[model samples]
Target: MNGARGKRRFLLALCALAALLFGALGVWQVELPCQTLDLIERVDARVHAPSGPIPPRSSWPRINAKSDEYRHVLVRGRFLHDRETLVDALTERGAGFWVITPLRAAEGPILINRGFVPRGRASPSSREAGQVAGEVTVTGLLRLTEPGGRFLRPNDPAGNRWYSRDVAAIARARGLPGAAPFFIDADASANPGGLPVGGLTSYRLRKRLLDVALVIMTSPVTVPLTILGALLVRITMGAPVLFVQSRTGVSGQPFRMYKLRTMRPLAPSEALQATSAGDVRITRVGAWLRRFRIDELPQLLNVLKADMS
Candidate 1:
């Protein structure tokens, strides 16, 4: 009788633990939207706060996404129209490109996302009127560098194809001296021609909610499985159980795509070939992971990071 009573108590405790665990998970998932909304509100507050002078060159080292991103700032400089680079973008008006022009500020050159232009009006000549020359004051929100290429397509400097507005890369490609570490998104003030529409930002709540749902539902199952898989991969294959590659995201933006390493490290030349069923390059554990689609579980993190859905 005592043994049976003890068994019942053990079962009840197990059930209670599971209920608590699942309940916690559900609460966390539900709070995601609220957390995101709060963040957006904070950013909006910063953006609307009284404009301040652009951070000087000496302060560049300390500036980061947390401290400076989306902060409204004032800058006066000459626009380097000749060196402007167009980054692929998608906005409410449909597919377009951001005209990124460098502003020759006193402290240093600062890249400015002048505005968005539809595919038809991408060329400078097409939107010549809005291309203001000479020194001008620009007040807008500062944005951090978006390094790497979007999705599967990496930034191709040689071809002049850029997906993300990577400040360092753009400065290097444009041969600009003393370029600032960040860029500025121009405000909604009307330009001469209205070709490159300023002050356009993209946010899709429905898509974000859907992505959150996917991460929440799959994480409980995938998290532990991924950990076990990592251990197995390490034992069978060696260290470095994961691999990260740059891939394009929404609106041709670039983001890092994460995945479990599924094959032996290969030479640059050998890595180009597609894997066959009997290929020796793939490790035994990698083969199993690929077969069961277990290798893709880590991408749930990318979804959480808003890089993928």
Candidate 2:
């Protein structure tokens, strides 16, 4: 009788533990989902659109030049010849470069992303063939200039290498003053064949698997074990299990963003040289680490570090 009673107690304790863990997982899921789009939406609410004609000259947004509030300006300007900068860009089509030309606006110089050109268009002939001349009207999304380069690589103006659409950097490199706080996303009608394939602006938020997984670890042991696994991976790899490269944030300022690294360290220029499944450049441990997202544990640190802000 005592044995059966003890067995019943054990079973009840197990059930209670299971219930507690599931409840904890459900709570976690409610907290840490992808909030990028949520933050974007909140920002969008604060930005009031321009009604009717452009606001008075003095009423324009102040240009410490570091806010997305300046985006979506409808400006009329002429392209400045010989001052165009080709920036490295990627698109759904393929990887290539962009033709960011300065548009001489009455108020200030606004950079216009003319369009995308493939690697084959890496010459003057290709640029000339696609150049649009004379007075023209362009209406596209105004993006705040991202000054620094992309993926932690600094923009080397001397080498003509650019990876981000930082207007201030480009303007400074081109030796132009009075540059606008933002750049325009050239519409499809402006340069259809241009690199980056203009009109590639639609962004949708997707539910991340990590968010789901974390939320499901409701069991007390499961949550702690998962967290322990993540911690173990981080301890094995050094401080940053997830690496945040300095990316050009809105309006030419620098911000660090997170990503999982699957490659061994190399010369800065040689970063992210693509590796297939069997590539030798990846460490055996890192490869397996990448597969299971043990490499991504550092992003929790990133999140705690408030790098996303």
Candidate 3:
């Protein structure tokens, strides 16, 4: 039939586009999955090693989450108890505050995340014993500063309320002219007062290599299906056959997720927060795509693109 011939031609065009994309993006991404186990073992060795010297200020600018974050490091400094900031936290111990205090180290002032203190013991007076006044040695994991506040809730420096541990914001608020851009999460060396608990950081390394393998293995069926789906979307809807969504990835990085457009454009007055199942914005074609979960096919490309989430 004429319709079948059109579909074959459309598929060839889609294949050409995919080939161009692969050529541009460097498509052989299956190496990571094969090396994932080896990578995990290597990371474990580095993470569990004995405390080492903190990266000097000269090299701070070169520090990165990939090479330096979570490395065990040592620093000796006097705690500036008065300048300590408490950021809201929820740990295994329950809802509490992370006591982020400035340490006057020889290199410079660096923030030390003393640890979580329960809500009832959030006041400094309640955990007085842990607040050592004299010079002390802190041996713990070095952490990269989390800049922007947590999701939806931004830090209020004026009001002294912090939802996340932002280094620059805290430094400005506490009047530290020169402070390190990173912080240290103190190890679980028992504090005298036993209020703020340390060494509660969790390290979860995602294994996205298998995602690459899966996509490569299923490409035969998936490639054709994706092209077919795109064609269907174009015929059913109008222009802009793909819907792109912004999502958070590893270490608060933003990524664009691709999917076949299923819903009609929403009106300006519509709520952007949530879309209900019965919402009028859902087109008949979109409803069908949702029912069969065909809209997820395009995400196979996300796996190839170094982010599988």
Best by lDDT: 1
Residue 20, candidate 3: how far off, in angstroms? Answer: 3.4
* Ranking of candidates on lDDT, top first: 1, 3, 2
- TM-score (all chains, Cα) for each model: 0.63, 0.56, 0.67
lDDT of 3 by residue, 25-122 (tens): 34433454346545555556656999899998999889987788778899998999999999987665777899999999999999999888988998
Summarize candidate 1's per-residue lDDT along 144-263 as a digit string, tens digits.
999987767679988999888999999999999689999998887788888677776423444665677566666667765676577677657777888788787665567778888889
User: Which is the winner by lDDT between candidate 1 and candidate 2?
Assistant: 1
lDDT of 2 at 49: 54
Clashing residue pair totals per candidate (backbone < 3 A) = 9, 14, 1
lDDT (Cα, tens digit) per residue for candidate 2, span 1-309: 999998688667756765786677677656544353354454444233542222334644553323443344466778886898888765545667777888877777778886677778866476564666777676655566677876456788888899888877888989888776567776565452343355444220112323333433433444454444434434344444445677553223456666555555567777767668787766665677677765555454433442332
Greater-TM-score candidate between 1 and 3: 3
